[model samples]
Target: MTKTIVITGTSRGIGFELVKLFAAEGHTVFALSRNDKPVKGLNLDNVFTFSCDLNKASEVSEVAASIKSQVESVDVLINNAGQFLKQEFKDTKMEDVKSVYETNVFSVFDLTHKLLPLMKESTHVVTISSMGGVQGSMKFPGLAAYSSSKAAVITLTELLAEEYKENGPSFNVLALGAVQTEMLEEAFPGLEAPISALDMAEYIKDFSENGQRFYNGKLLQVSSSTP
Candidate 1:
């Protein structure tokens, strides 16, 4: 059966790859992002793109209307949009922290809250997180704002899982390690990531469904190292 999957941050990276992966499988995919379209050379007719700034709550409402107009229910929801900043705590401004939370943490809540009615009983909510949020792990020095926002995501996922246990739709978090993508490159200039964005996207597509089937309120960390 063809599933309806909704993914955020489809402008690039893992989200872009996921749009292709799921659409090639003949699933109906809704790609949401600030950009008006998918990245160049990644366009697919199976994937419908919605342009909306997630940081703005009003835009999210408008997009929700657009989504509901087309699809009656969602099988999978991937909250993958995020903002990252590489700056020491002392150098990171409060505004940067607020911006990171706006995109990374709060936007997930806003969009998920609005889309809950469109999700069926078996819908899965997968939010991308980072290993930096893991306690006692390899906590990098310069990612205070980014890491904290990811931590908030993890906690929020847990809360949502429990909050909606009786209602419907499962919630899970994938706390990924550094993946080789533009976002990782921007944060750590020359360092190499053991996992590729394409590979992670493939894993996420399977895990989102499988995790929702067997697990709830769990945080699975994917990494090549302890971090």
Candidate 2:
């Protein structure tokens, strides 16, 4: 009953906690990140580490090839790696928008496309998004680029679901509220959040396991309140 799960962005935050959560459950986990070292104190036998910059096409392809060689099928692929930027639309640099999209949107698409061959019937593809991405939700002053990039991720998730649902691997995006993580602190310094990365990781664990049964091509907002 141990599923083979591939998770990206395990260097820290929710993705790091997810590696621990899945490995503790005895699932075979492939943890991908730019950092070469595994998370501190997580040396479980079931966790395999791969160091790759997801924004780099060659590195992503190489890592995908290596994973395909080792595992015939992957039960879940969690595209949790993302970048956030804080700048008003007028002041935002084009380079910042492109950079955020490269990591948050294009990288997710690239990795998922490469790993599609390894996914079978009923597999799950969950990508992390943000509450700001949800239309008509709370609006922020300096998150134009970051929010739009996440919006693209949700749209991409819908299209992928339509394209691949018949074969396997239902696609979904989790638009999350503020979580207490380094990323959050970077975006909004000194703000306390209702949820922590570890709490989000626990919710994502259950969602990754049972989401396809009730939801696919859906953007499920994970937040306790408007943030």
Candidate 3:
């Protein structure tokens, strides 16, 4: 059976990899991102791409409506669109914090809420969190806003899992340590030795198929070193 999946932040990074993996496996993948340009070098014909700035609640809503109109249900939704802004507390601007929260937290929540009705029982909702969301990562400097937003997402995932455990979609947060993505390049110039997006995508594909049975409602960390 071919499942219909929706993946945000599909222009690049882990989300893009997920879109490719699922589509390659014969699933209908709705790839959403701000950039509507077609994915290059992908041979899968089961993928559909949409362009929308996920930071905007209205835009997120529109995307949800569009998906609902096209597909009766989405078997999986990967909320992978997020922003990371690194600035010292003293130098951080309020607008930047708001923007981070809007992109990383509020927009995801709004889209999830809007799409909840389109998910049937056993549907999977995966929110891509960061290791920074964990308790011990406070030592990382200049991550206050981004980390806090991810923490909120963790909480939201937990609540959603608990509230809908019986009859609604399952929710879980994948707290990744580090992956070789554009975000990592922007965060730490010249940094190396992170997990590859393809590997991470494969891990997520397996998790999406079975992790809920063992790790649903909990934060599962994934790193290059973890096997």
Candidate 4:
């Protein structure tokens, strides 16, 4: 069966890789991103692309409307869109914090709430979280806003999972560690030897397909040493 999948932030990074993987596997992939540029090398017939700034609630509503018109049920939803502002609490502007929350937390909640009605029983919803979400990192400086937002996402993921546990869909948060992506570069420049996006995508694909059965309602960590 060709499952209907929705993935956000498909313009680049792990989200882009995930869209390609799912689409190539013959699943219907609705790839959402701010940029509508053509994805090179994705020749799959099952892929559909949409441009929506996740920071705006109205744009999210528009995307939801379009999805409703075409797809009846979403088998999986990957909330992979996020923001990270690596500034100290004292130095971080209020606007930057608001923007981070809007991108990392608020938009995710809004989109999930709107599209959740379209999800059937046993549908899987995954959110890309960070290891920083689990415990506050004293080792790293200047990431208070980013880390806090991700922690909020982790909480939201757990709440949603419990809310839908008995009769509806499943939800899980993937707390990834040190993935070598543009976000990493933006957050921590000059850091070397992070996990590749392809490897991260493969891990995510496997988890989405099989790991969800056991790990639903849990925060699964993915790192270089994680098995």
Say which candidate scores most in TM-score. 2
Clashing residue pairs, backbone N/CA/C < 3 A, model 2: none
Q: Answer with 1 or 4, whichever has the higher TM-score.
A: 1
**What overall lDDT goes with each candidate model?**
0.89, 0.91, 0.83, 0.84
Query: In terms of TM-score, how similar is model 2 to the real structure?
Result: 0.97
lDDT of 3 by residue, 12-95 (tens): 888888887888789988888888575534756788777888887788888888888888898888888889899999999999
What is the TM-score (0 to 1) of candidate 3? Answer: 0.93
Please, what are the lDDT tens digits per residue for candidate 4 over residues 8-113?
A: 9888889899988887788998888888575534666788888899998898999999999998999888999988788777888999999999989998899899
lDDT of 2 by residue, 1-227 (tens): 99999999999989999999999989999999988485635778888888888889999999999999988899999999988899778888998889999999999999999998888878999999999998889888999889888899999999999998787789999999989999889888999999989999999999999998999899999999667
Question: lDDT rank, highest first?
Answer: 2, 1, 4, 3
Query: By TM-score, is 1 or 2 better?
Result: 2
Clash number by candidate, in order? 0, 0, 0, 0
Off by over 4 Å in 4: 38-43, 136-139, 225-227
Tens-place lDDT digits, model 1, residues 1-227:
99999999989899999988998999998888888555434667777888889999999999888889998899999999989898888888999899999999999999999999998779999999999987767888888999989999999999999998987789999999879899988878887888898999999999987788898999998888644
Order of the predicted models by TM-score, top scorer first? 2, 1, 4, 3
Query: Candidate 3, which ten residues in sequence have the lowest lDDT sum?
Result: 218-227
Give the winner by lDDT: 2 or 4. Answer: 2
True lDDT of residue 37, candidate 4: 74
Query: What is residue 108's positional error in candidate 2, in angstroms?
Result: 0.8
Itemize residue pairs with steric clashes in candidate 1.
none
